[model samples]
Target: MKKRRRDLIQLSILVVLGAAVILSLVLPQLPGRGRELQPLELSVIFREADTALWSNTRLGMEQAAGDLGAELRFLTLTRTGDGAEQTELLRREADGGAGALVVVPADPENLKLQLSETVGSCPVVSIESPLEGAGLVVAPDNEALGRELAEAVLEDWRGGMVLLLDTAVGSTGVAARLDGAEAVLTAAGVPVFRQTAAPGRLAAGLRVLSSVQKAEAIMAFDPYATEQTIRAVEAGGLGQLVYGVGVSTYVVGALERGSAAAVAAWSDYAAGYLAAEGAIRLARGEAYTAEELPFTVVRGEDIYEADNQKLLFPVTS
Candidate 1:
């Protein structure tokens, strides 16, 4: 009897030990591991151009990095949009031995090639605009955004001319949004007037807005472009006739003033935060995938409220 009892106790101890080993292996996969998250180093390289937007994005990234106890390096190659400058910065960071890199390349074509040669072995992620064959990418569903914008236009104006404002025709993000918008509009048998702006010219957006003969709505690809269109329409005394669709504080203000009809905005803060998270995951020798943060469409009275202010990144405004 004594021998049997001792055997039973030993077997129970073995079972408990086995269970603990299994738990340790599966705990990280469970939600909120709550382990003392390790500190990580991440380099964020912005495109030489879009300084203001990059700054805003960096703020979010920094905040997230701080929360996650990670070190962040935010660098810009030039004040103006220069692909060569961005390429040089990427090369430098790679040589400096960063744990991970989050880059917004200036020129997709040239930067893609340079990145392939320079940072090919490193864990690199892209946001806003994706680099082809990147390890990770964070961007809105451009097609979905486009469809949402088109539907917003249809809701306000059923049969009038709708103008689509894009920064560049070849830009992957812009092209995707345009394609999505076009699909929805075509399905509804609505005509779309699309125009591409000159590189780095807000005036080009205004020019398109001014040139529209019977414009019912204007959908801008970015916040800055949206602001320019609003200014142009207001100056031309066409604010009442034209509806704007954009994502930014300025666009929200426009909506409050009844100038912008709707704005589809992604969480810049969340993207920045997630970018930092991805960097840390990469640093931990863990494989990670690109992901998109949640997005919201702000319009009507919600644009002016304090609660709705979350839509705008803290860094931008």
Candidate 2:
């Protein structure tokens, strides 16, 4: 009888132990007991100063940071395309304990080297342009953007001289765009003349070029260049149809005014969101598949269409 009683007690204890073990495994995943993740500090470094051009992108990033329970800091270079400045900022952020970083590299080659030495184990994501060593790159296919802009120009093109405005002349992004544009225009047998200049001075260069060479159509590779072309065309009374990439108030206004022919733009907002999300994922050691960013060509006639408006103007509230 005593032996049987002891065995019964032992079995009762074993059953209780099993039940406790099962509860331990299940309780953490229960509705009210889910694990809480601490917010991470993320830093975003831009190649240039903050401007209206970045508003939509910034909004998207801010929203993502909020949604993902992360802190975000935005830093920009005082001078555009200052690779050294960008590199220094990267070092500073990493040393300052930034959980992750998103960069728009001003000089990819130099930054690529710097990133290897400076960032240690922190994850990095790049946007706008490519940095070879970044953990991820979130940007539209720049070459495709250029091709679409070229096609837009050819829609009404009767073929004369088409001027290719090379804004930010030496950038990898711009170079890719130029390649795509040139390929399309050359294949069509359109006479293409190229002009290279910095963003702020592109309009002046355009005016000077127009004085000596008459072109039937102008293709600007970036927002500032496109806006400058519109201003140069309108203020100088030069009658050249303009097409380009990017969206800003100036570019959109030009489109509405019919001074600009067409603009190729992607959801910069989406680019921003993806960059933030990627940084967080990489930081957490989570696996991520890069999302493809698609582009759209907006013309004056369809600028107000719901889809285009959603891209150009997002409801950040």
Candidate 3:
């Protein structure tokens, strides 16, 4: 009887081994199991010529590309707000066999028009600006970001004129931010004046406007504008409390030095990482969903906090 029991145990072990081999073969064939995705070629186009503003974003993209086995080509316009140039670049990248296209649209309306005409088979993902019917969009809620900035100003604002500076005049994202800030300030019975400047002339414009308009506080709607506004304020000795949106190094430094009061910032690092990953998944025919990253209002005191530090300064390595 003992010999019979030993033989039965050996038979059971053999049966288990056979089942494992069958599973190993069949599992790979099943959906969502051990599938090797093809390496993808991704193209990213930014709306502006200054790639410096997108440094953290680029790092995030590079990290995702390395992790996901994808090749990335980064492109930017020769001038800010060059819709025609952006369209041409999009067409060239797609026709040159890019598996996916990611864009910070210089002109969202123009890009939406080009999407069907230019991109034949490749999927398109938009970052920082939303394109309706585009596969996915990864960005912060611009309106909310604006409201946050405005609220930061309202915290200590007793009363007086507040200037809403619009450096990127045509950007829907920037416009949304301006609108949000306006809504909040207007609802609070604050007098707000909307201001606009030509690209590359915001500093000069601010210098001229501040000399005449007499705003008690200045709120810039984008990163470049915010940086320029802060510099203009300090250089002119305008004494207007500066508040804006963005988290660039200069903006952070200004906040630390108390030249700028506060900034509404989101993680551009997360934005870049999500855009690349979303494009790859769309290229691979996998499921992808639009992502809206959150924002934070960083003041002088909040800059060094652990959570805010990560939001403001992402570790590239």
Candidate 4:
């Protein structure tokens, strides 16, 4: 009887030890143990490498990602026309477990459908270009931007013709900008002529733009077009004044050199941050939606102002 009792006690001890070992091994993964949360996976796609025009937006995304404990995957398509590349990247990221997506679409309209079919369930945020299928889009008010620039031209009331230039092969947003600017210019009786420039064809654009009389004011819809206009001016000055819609490091030089009168700078950082945050919220089943980032018409002197200084110098990291 004594031997049997000792054996029974030993068995109980062994069972207790085994249970404790199992619990120790498993408890950390259970809900009650530590309750730690993991970071989410987020991704972003750009038409090309990050630039001064996109630095603010990228920084904004980084800030939001850090705050939200998300990992950001940034991809750039270097080719001149790579809309298809963007769609493929979208598929690859989604398949590889990206919970949310943010993109500056190479072809905004075509990417819209591809995004829906490939990652339709994932919450998507469109950066500068608005996507029809995205859950939320963060973009500057381009119409307001165009209107503001035109108003500035009206204030100066330069008698020379106003020239509008855009390189969007198929962009709806450019149309909105043109409409807004034209509305103001036509109302004020500013003569306007528009031309589309092929990529790396500034000379051809110049030849196309040539007229008997020089233009009074020129509006370039995007930064590239603006740079071409600047290059054209450097090669052979065309208009009396120039205005552009986006910000680039070169913009500072343009303003200093008096090549560009002013540029309607969009809150690119806000666009990046808000789009990322909003997409995350949507992915997490929150009630997040589309938002419009603000814009500012900045000139050479305006760069000295506190707000304009930040816009002039943005932190990307």
Evaluated with TM-score, which candidate comes out highest?
3
Tens-digit lDDT track for model 1 on 52-85? 6545567778887777677888787654446677
lDDT of each: 0.68, 0.82, 0.84, 0.75
RMSD of 1: 9.8
Model 3, C-alpha of 242: deviation from truth (Å): 1.5
Say which candidate scores most in lDDT: 3
Model 1: lDDT of residue 224: 53
In Å, residue 202's CA in model 2 sits off its true spot by 2.5
Candidate 2 at residue 139, lDDT?
Answer: 76
Write the number of the candidate with greater TM-score, choosing between 1 and 2: 2
lDDT of 3 by residue, 93-121 (tens): 98899999999887888888788787866
TM per candidate comes to 0.75, 0.83, 0.85, 0.82
Candidate 3 lDDT trough over 10 residues, lowest sum: 204-213
**If both were scored by lDDT, which would come out higher, candidate 2 or candidate 3?**
3
Between prediction 2 and prediction 4, which has the larger lDDT?
A: 2
Where in model 2 is the C-alpha error above 4 Å? 1-38, 203-205, 210-213
Ranking by lDDT: 3, 2, 4, 1
> RMSD in angstroms, candidate 4?
4.5
TM-score of 4: 0.82
